[model samples]
Target: MQKPHSINLSFLAFIGVLYSFQSILGAITFQGMPAVFRQSGIPPIQIGFIYLLMLPWIFKFIWAAPLETWRQKKGRRTNWLFLVVNSVAIVMLLLLTLTTPDVGLYFIFILLAIIAILSATVDTALDGFAIKESNALDKNWVNVMQIGGGYLGSIVGGSLFLLLVGRYNWKFAVYAMVVLLLMMLCYVLFQQQSVKELGQKSAKQSLQKTFASKQVQYGIFIVVIAQLGLRLAQGMTMPFFIDYGITLTQLGVIGSIGGATASLIAVFLTGLWVTKKGPGFVLISLLAVQISMYFAFYYFSEKAELTLLQASFLLLSNSACVAASFVALYNLLMRLTSPEQAGVDFSLLQGVDTAIALIAGVISGALVQYLGYQSYFLLCALASFSALVALPLLNKSSSPLKVVI
Candidate 1:
C-alpha cells in the first residue's frame, strides 16, 4: 500500500465532509423521517417498513466488487462520487423540497431509497480511498473522520432537520439540506484527487479468495460479536425512556445533546487511543467500558422513577462508549483490508455489521417485551462480555496490532 508522505489536513477535511454528507441521508432515512411519519399519523407497521429502504446499505457489498473493478482506472472513484452526488442525491433532495410529507409520502420513500443507494455506493468508494491513502499508523485517524463526521451529520439531519420541520416546514428543511449538499459537492469538485493505484496482480484476486483468508473470517466474527450487544441495548432505549415517562421533547433534547455530541468526542478520543495503544488494546478496553455501561443501564431500568439527569447520563455515556468502540472496531477492520480490494473487503464487513445491528434491533424489541428492560439489559451485558472472551481468538492473527489479549 502506498502511504502519503505526511498527514494531510486537507485530505482529512475532505474525508470528514464526504462522510458527513453521506451520513446526512442516512440520518434522514433512519432517524428523522420515522419520527415525522409517526407524528403525521402514519401507522406503526407502515413506518416499520421504512427500514427496508436501508436494504441498499446491507446489500451494497454485492455491487462493491464491480465498483472496485471500475476504480482500477485513475480518478474513476472521484468521478463516480461527483456523478452520484449530482445526479442522484442532489436531484432527490431537490425533488423532496417540492413536496410535503402528507401528500408525497410514497414519493418521498422512493426518493430516499434512491438516495440510500447513492450513499452506499459513495461509502464503498470513499472507504477504499481512505484505506489506500493512509498507512497503518494513521488509519485510526481516518476512522475518526469517518465516524466523527457521521455523528455531526446525524445531529444535523436527525435533530436540526426535525427542529426545522417543527418550526417552519418540510420543504424549507429539505431545501436547507440541498444547499448543504451543494456546498459539499463544490468542495469535492475543487479538491484534487491523490489516490495511488494498486498492483493489478493483487487486484485480480477473486472475491471468494479474499473472504477465504483466516484473517477475514476472524474480522467478520469480531464485527458481529462486537456490535450485537450495542445494537440490542440501543434499540430499546427510546421505548425504555417512554415507558419510564420521558416526554418526546425531552427525548429529543437528550438525544441531541447526549447522543451525537458525546459520540463525536468519543470518536476523536478513541482514534488517538487506537493510534497509540493499537486497536486490539482499544477494543478490549472499550468493551469493558461498554459492559459497565450496560450494567448501569440495568440499574437505571430498575429505578422506581427515572430523572432526566439520570437518563441523560446513561444515554450520553453509553453513546460515547458505542462511538469509541466503533472507532476501534473499524480500525481493526481497516488493518485487515487488502490494498488491492479495500472497497470489497471493507464493504462486506460493514454489510455484516449492519445486518447484525438490524437483526439485533428486531430481537431487542421482542426480548424487552418478554423480559423487561432490566433483564434485557443484563442479557446485553452478557452478550458484550462474550465478545471479550472472543477477543483472544481475533487477536491471534497477522494484523499489525499487538495480540494484547
Candidate 2:
C-alpha cells in the first residue's frame, strides 16, 4: 500500500461537502423549489417532472464499478473526483443561472438529471476513498465527521435558506449556491489528494470476480434488503406527515431547526456511545429510539399540546439514528470489501441499496395515494424492524479498515 501524504481537518471537511450536497438538494427541493417554482410562474408538478430527470441517482452503481481501476492506473482518485465534483458544481450553477419555466419543463429536468448523474459519480468515488483511507476504529468517526459537515450545510441551506433568503428573494438562493460552489472550489484546489496506486489487478479483472463470486451475490442481497428497510423507515414517515396537512414551511421548520439540531446532537452523542459501548450498540439503540419516536410522533400528530414537542423529538432522534448509522454501515462496507476490488465491491453495495430505495420510492407514492395515512408509516416502521433483526449478522464483522494499496 502506498502511504498517502498526511491529511487534515480541511480535506475531511471537503469530503463532507461532497456527501452533504445531496441532503442540501433534498432540503431545497422539498422547501425551496415549491416557492421558486411559484415565483417563476412554473407549475408545482413541473418541479417534480424536472427532478425526474435526475433519476440516475437510483442506479449510479452501474457506472461506478468501472472506476475501480480507471483512476488507479493514473495513480490517484483525483482524476475521477475532479471530473465528478467540479462538473456537478458547474452544471448546477448553470442550472440555477439558466432555468426558466418557459425553457420547457422537460428540458430543465433533463439537464438536472445530467448534474445528478455527475454528482452520484462523485459520491460513489468518495465512499470508496473514505473506506480506503480510514481504519476499522476510525471508520465511524470518519463517517460522523463527513455527515456532520453535511448536516451542518443542510441546516443552513435547508432550514435557514428558505426562511431568510427565499422569503427575501428567490434569486438569493442562486447566489447562496454560487458562494458555496466557490468555497467548495477553493477547498478542492488546496487539498492534497496524494493517492498512491493500489498495487492490484486492474478494474476489469476485479469486476469479473465480483460477478463470479457467490459470496458477493449474498453480500449484495444483504446490503440491498437492509437498505430498502432503512429507507422505508424514512419514506413512510415523511409522506404521512405531509398527508396530515403539515405545511411545507412547518415541515421545513421542524427539519431545519429541529431536524438539523437533533442531527448535530446525534453526531456527538454517537461519538460518545461508540466510545463507551461500540458503533453497533450505538446504532441499534438509535434505531430503536427513532422507531419509537415515529410512533410517538404519529400519536402526537393528533394532539395539540404535544404535537410540536413530540414531532421535534421524533425528527431529532431520527437524525441521530441516521448519523450514528452512517458510521456503522460505512464501516460494514469497508469490512466486507477486498483490495483487488474496492470500487466494484462498494459500488455493488451502494447500487443494491439505491435500487431498494428506487422501488420504495414508487411504493411510497402509491401507498400514500391508496392506503390510510397511518399505514404508510406503519409499513416504514416494519421495514426498520426487519432490518433491525438482521443487524446481528450484518455487523458480525468487527474488521478494521485499510488502504487498498
Candidate 3:
C-alpha cells in the first residue's frame, strides 16, 4: 500500500491551461468555422453536418484501454502527447489559413476531422491525468478548473477569435490562433511532469466490473440524458443568433465578456451549493434551472424585439445555466468513478455522452427546419425534462462509491 500524492495548485493550474488550449482547438473547429460558414450563406443543415467531424470523440474509448497500457510502460506522457498533437494542429491551422470554405470546403472538413482525432486523444489523456492526480475532495475543484478554464478558453478562442475575424480577415484570425498555439506549445514543452504517474494495466477487468453493476448502468443513463438537450440546443445557437440579426462582433463581446464572467460566477456559486447540499441535489436543481432557461429564451425570442442589453442578459443567463449544469453532472460522474479504473470508467461515461450528443447535434438542424426556433427550443426543454424521469435511478440507498486515491 502507498500514500497518494497530495493535490497541488501547480498541477491543477497546468490542467486548467491544458483545458484552455484544447478549447482553443475546439473553438477553431466549432466556433470559428461555423461563424465563417454561416456568414458565407451555408445552410443550417450543412452547418449541422460540420459536427460530424467531431465524431472521433465519441469513439476515443476504442483506443483508451490500449493507451492505458502504453502509458504504463512510457510513464507520464501528457506533455509528449500534448506537444505532438498541438504541433500537428498548428500545421493544420497554417494550411487552413490559405483556404476558404468557399474554395475548399470539403478539404477543410477533412483537415478538421484529423484535428479532432488528435484533440480527442489529448482530451482522453488529460482526463486520466486529472483523475489520477486528485483525491475525492480535490475532484470537485478539478471539475471547476475544467469548466472555468473552458469558459476562459471560449472567451479567447470563440469570442476573441471572432472579433479578429471581423476586424481584419479570416487569415488574420487563423494567424492569431497559430501564435497562441505556439505559446501553448512552448509552455507544454518547458513544464515538468509534476504528479506521480500511475502504473498502467489492462482495463478489461475494470470494464467488466463496471458494466456488471446496476448502479453504474443507472449512472450512465443519467449522464446521457442530463447532457442531451444542452448539446442539441448549443449546436443551433450561433445560427439562431445570426438569423436574429445579431452581428458577429456583438456576439463576440457578449460571449467573451458577459458569458465568460457569468459562467465563472455560476461555477463558484455551484461549488458552494455542492459543498453544502451534495452533488445529487445540485444536479437535479441545475437541471430544473436549465429547463426553465430554455423556455425563458423561447418566450423572449417570440414575444418581443430584444435590444442589445436584453440579448446580452439572456446570453449571460444561458452561459450561467450551462456552466452550472456541467459542474453538477461532472461532479456526479466523479463520484461514480473507481480510483483503480478511473481512465476506462470516465472515458466510457464521456464517450457515451458524446455519442448521444452527436446524434442530437446531427438532427438538430433538421429539427429546427421542421419545427422552427420556438418549437425547437421547446423540444430541447422537453428533452431536458426527460432526465427528471431518471432521477429515481440515482436514489439508491447507499452513498456513491468513494474514490480511494
Candidate 4:
C-alpha cells in the first residue's frame, strides 16, 4: 500500500462541487421526475421504466478504460473532460426545457437519457481523479464529498426543483438547473491545478487485468448484495408518498429540510466511524439499521392512515441510513481499486452496483403493484437480511488479496 498522502482541503472541496453537479442531474432524473410523473397519473409500472434511462451508468466501465487512455495520451486532466461533458449536459437540459409531459414526454426522456450518458462519463473521470489525488487515510473524506455532495444536490434537484415546479412552473424549475450547471462549469474552468497524471504505467493498464483481481470480484459480490434491496425499496418511496396523499411541496420540504440534514449528518459520522472502525464493521452495523428501517416502513405501509410527521420521520431516518451505508460501501470499493487502473477498477465496481440497483428499481414498481406496499417492504427486509448473513463471506474473500489502498 502507498504511504498516506497529506490532505488537501481545496482539492476535496473542488471534488465535492464537481460531484454535486452530477448528483443534481441524477436527483432530477431519478427522483424529481418520477414523483411528477406519478402525480400526473402515470402508472407505477410505466414509471418503473424510467430507471432504464440510467443504463449508461451501469455499463460505463465498457468505455472507462478507453477514456482514461485517451486522457493520458492527450495529457489532459480529468477536469478537462468534466468541463466538456457537463457543457454538453447543460445543452441537453436546455433542450429538455422546450418539451413538456403533455406534448413531448418521449422527447424529454430521450434527452434525459443523453444527459445520463454525459453524467456517467463525468463520474468515471471524477472517480479516477479522486483515487489518484487522495491516499488511503483521506479517501474516506473523498467519499464524504461524493456522498455528502450527492445529498446536497438532492436537496437542489429533488427538493428545490419540485418546490419550484409546484410554486412556479416546469420551465422555471429547469432554468434554475441550467444556471447552476453554468456556475459549476465556470468554477471548474477557473481552477488553477490540473490533476496529477498517471503516466506510462497507468496508460498500460487494462480492464482485463482489473477484472481478474480477487479484490475486484469480491467487491462486486458485496456491492450487489448490499445495495439491491435498498435500491428496490427506495425506488418506490416517492410513488408511495404520492399514493399516500403526500403533496409535491410536502415531499420537497421533507427532502430539502429533513432528508438533507439527516443524510449529511449520517455521512459525516460514517466517515469518522469508517476511519476509526474500518468499513467492514461500519457496513455491517449500518446494514442492520437499514434492515430495521425497512421493517418500519413495512409497518407504516399497512396503516389505515399516516400523518405527515410520521411519514417525514420514516423518510428522514431511512435517508440517513442510506447515506451512511453508501459512504461505507464506497470507502470499501475505493480501497479495492488499484491506482494503475483506477478508472476501470472503480468504474467496474460502481457499474456492478448500479446494474443491480437499476434492475431492482426497474421492477420495484410492478412488484409493489402486484404484492402491495406491505408485502414489498417485507420482501426488501428479507433481501437486506440475506446481505447481512453474507457479510462474513466478504471477510473471507478479502484474505486472498491484499487491499489496494
Candidate 5:
C-alpha cells in the first residue's frame, strides 16, 4: 500500500493565514465601523450602507459554481485561488492609497462594495482549499486549523485590530489588511501544489456532479437543514446582544475573547472525543447547548455584573457549539469529497449555508425592528424548532473510515 500523506506543515500554515484573512476582512470593515465612521455630519444610515455592502458574500456562490467547474492545465483548484488572492492584494493596496473620509456616502459605499466583492471571492477560494486539502486522518485537525484561524482572526482583528483602528487612522487599517492578504498569498505560492492534487473542477459540471452523489446530496440536506434552524435562531438573538443595554465594545469582548477562547479549547478537546464515537451525538449535543444559550440572550441586563456573567455563559455555549458543529461539518465534508471535485463540493456546501443565512439575516433584522428585542428572541426560540426538524434527517450511517479511540 502507498504511504498516507500528512497535510504538509507549510500547507497547513497557509490554511491558517487564509482563514485568518477571511475573519479579519469582513470584521475590520463591519465591527470597527462605528469607531471610524463619523455620524457627525453623515447620517447613521450611511454607515448602515457600509454594512449592506457585505451582501455580495450572500451571493458569492454564484461565482463559486464556476470555480468548481473550471479546470486549469493541472486538475488542482489552486489556480483559481491564486488569482483570487492576487486580486485581493491589488485591491487592498488600491483601497489604502485612496483616501475616502471626505468622499460622499455613495462613493464610500461603492468602494466598500468593491472590497466586499473581492474579499468574498477570496473567501470562496480559501474554503474550497480547506475542503480539498483535508484527508480522513487529518479531517478533524483540518477543522481545528480552520476554526483556530477564525478565532485568531476575530480576536486579532475584532478586538486587537478594532483597538488599533480606534487609536490610528484609516490608512493604518488599510495597511493592516494589505499585510495580512499578502502573507496569505505568499503561503499559497509556497505550497507548490499542482491543480489535480487540489481538485479544481469546472463549475459547469460541479452542481450536476454534486447531485449525482447520493451521499453528497444527503449530507447537504442534513447540513443545510441544521444550518437553517441554527442560523435563523441565532440571527434573531444576536442583533440584540449589543443593542439592548449591552454596549458594543463589551459585547465585542464577550464575542471575541470569551467566544474565541472557549471555541479554541472545545475544538481541540472535541477532536479527541470525535475519535471515540462518530460526530452524530456530538453535533446534536452542541445544537441543544446553543439553543439553551440563545434563551439567555433574552435575560441579559445592562448591569455590568449580570451582563458579564450572562455574556460569559452565552459565549461559552456559543463557542462550544461552534466547535462541535464545525468539527462534524469538516469531518463529513472531508469524508464525502472526491479529490476531483473537492473545491466544488465544499463551495456548494458553503453556498447552501450562505443562502440559509441570508434569508435568516434579512428576516431577523426586519423582525427585530418591527417587533422589538424580546419578541425577536421569541421568534428565535420558535425558529430553533427546526433543530428537531433536522434530527431525523441526520441519522448516522456508519463510515468505514479508520479512526483511533
Candidate 6:
C-alpha cells in the first residue's frame, strides 16, 4: 500500500500553474473561437449551439463513480488517466489548429466538444486529487489558485490568443496555444504523485451518504444557484461588448487583462477574508456585490454608450467580485467533502454546479433574443439574488462553517 502524502505548498502552486494553462486551453476553444465565430457573422442563435460543447461537463459526474472505484484498486489511481485524457485534448487542439472552422462550423464544434469531454475528465481527476490531499488551510489556497489561474488563462487564451489570430492568422495563434499546452503537459508528466491508497469502499455508497448529509445537500444547492447567475451574465458579455463597438482585439486585451488583474486581487483578498470571517459571510457578501454588477451592466447597456475604459472598469470590478464569491463558495465545497470519498463527493457537487451553469449558458442567447440585452441583464441580477435562499441552510448548528470535514 502507498503511504499517504502530506499536502505541500509547492505542489499546490504547481496545480495552480497547470489549472491556469488548462483554462487557457479551454478558453482558446470556448471563448476565443466563439468570438471569432460571432465576428464572422454567426448569429446568436446559431452561435448559442456552441454551448452544446459543454455537454461533457454537464455529465462528467457519471464517470466520477468509476474513477473513485478505480482509485480503490491501487497503483497511481487516476493520475495516468489524467495524463491520457490531457494528451487527447492536446491532440484535438492541434487538429483544431490545423483545420479552419470557417469552412464548416459543425465540424469544428464537434471536434471541440470532444476536446471539452477530455478536458473535463482531466479536471475531475485533478479536483479530486486536490480535495483528497489538501488540509483545511490548504483548501483556501487551492481555491484561490484555481480562480486566479483561470483568470490568467483567460488572459492568454482569450485575450492574447485572439489578438494573435486577428493580428496574424489562425495558425499563429494555434501554434502559440500548442506551445503552451506542451509546457503544461511536461509539468503534468513530471509532477510528483501524492495520491494516497484508497480503502475498499463502494463508490455508490459514498455518493448516497454524501447526498444524505443535509450540509452537502445545501452546499450543492448553494453551488448551483451561486454560479447560475454569473454564467448567465457572462454568457452574453462578448456579444454585448461587440454591440457597443468593442473589437475582438480590444476585448482580448481589455477584458482579459482586467479580469486577470481583478482575479489575482480577489484571490489574495478572499483568502484572507474567508479565513477570518468564514466562507459563508464571504460567499453572501461577494454574491450581493455580484448582483450589483449585473445591474450596473443593465444601466450602462440602457445608456447605449460605452467607452473602452468604462467597459473595462465594469468588467474588471465585476470579475473581482465574482472571483471572490467563487473562491468562498469553493472553500465551502471542499469543506463538505469526506476525504474517504473525496473523488465522488467533490465531483457530484462540482458536476451539479457546472451542469446548471451550462444550462444557463446555453439558454442565455435565447433570453437575449427574446428579452434584449438590458432586460436579460436585469434578469441575471434577479437570479443572483436567488442564492440567498441557501444561506439559512448553511447556519445549521450541527455543522459549523469553520469546521473542516
Model 2 segments beyond 4 Å from truth? Answer: 1-11, 22-55, 76-80, 83-85, 97-105, 135-137, 153-157, 164-166, 193-205, 212-218, 236-250, 275-281, 301-310, 393-405
Q: What digit string (tens of lDDT, one per residue) describes model 4 on residues 1-405?
A: 334655666677778888889999998998899888887778889888989987999899999988877766654556678888899999999997887766777998999999999999989888877776675436778888888987788778987788787778889889999998899789878763543443343555588988798778878878888887888888888888878877888888888888889989999999999988888888878778988998998888887666899889887998898889999989888888887788889999999988887898889989988989998898889988998888866566546323421
Return the top candidate by lDDT: 4
lDDT of 2 by residue, 1-405 (tens): 323444445546656766666556544543354334544555333433333433565566567667645655554455456545765656664566465534544554555556667666776666666555554225556667766866776665655655544345545656776677666665655554533322443445255676776545655655664565456554444434444445445655777777777778877666666656665555555556556755665565554343555556665666666656655555455556665556667777666766665566545555655764466566766766666676655455542211100
* Model 3 residue 68 lDDT score: 55
Q: How many clashes in each structure?
A: 0, 2, 0, 0, 12, 0
How many Å off is the CA of 229 in candidate 4? 1.2
Q: Which window of ten consecutive residues has the lowest lDDT sum in model 2? A: 396-405
lDDT of 1 by residue, 233-265 (tens): 766665566567665566567767667878888
Q: Tell me the tens digit of each residue's lDDT in model 5 across 138-198.
A: 7667777776776667555654554444456556756776676676666666664522343
Q: What is candidate 3's lDDT per residue for 1-405, written digit by digit as tens?
A: 334544567766777888888888887787767777888888878888888877888888678766655664555565677788778878887888768787789989988888889888888777776776666336678778887777677768887787787778888888998898788778767665554454444344245765675546656877777788788888777767767777778888888888888889998888778777777778777778878988987886684356687678778898888888877777778677666666667777888877877777778888877888898899889888887666645465443432210
Give the Å error, residue 147, model 3: 2.1
Q: If both were scored by TM-score, which would come out higher, candidate 5 or candidate 6?
A: 6
> Alpha-carbon error at 52 in model 4, in Å?
0.6
lDDT (0-100) at residue 98 of candidate 4? 88
RMSD from true fold, candidate 4: 2.4
User: Top model by TM-score, which number?
Assistant: 4
Record all residue pairs in model 3 with backbone atoms less than 3 Å apart, i.e. clashing.
none
> Higher-TM-score candidate among 4 and 6?
4
Error of 6 at 389 (Å): 5.5
| Per-residue accuracy of model 6 over 1-405 as CA lDDT, tens digit each | 333444456667667776786688677766787678878888777766777777777677778667666754654655677677778887877877656757867778777888888887777767766666565335677777777777678678877787787777887788888888888777767774643323343344255676776667766767777788888886777777777878777876776567777778877899899888878787878778888899889889886668988788886787687677778888888888777667677777877877776777778888887888889998889888887655655565565443632
- For residue 297, model 3's alpha carbon misses the true position, in angstroms, by 1.7
Considering lDDT, which of the candidate structures 3 and 6 is the better prediction for this target?
Answer: 3
Q: Candidates' lDDT values, in order?
A: 0.74, 0.57, 0.75, 0.83, 0.58, 0.74
Lowest-scoring 10 consecutive residues by lDDT in candidate 3? 396-405
- Compute the lDDT of residue 405 as modeled in candidate 4: 16
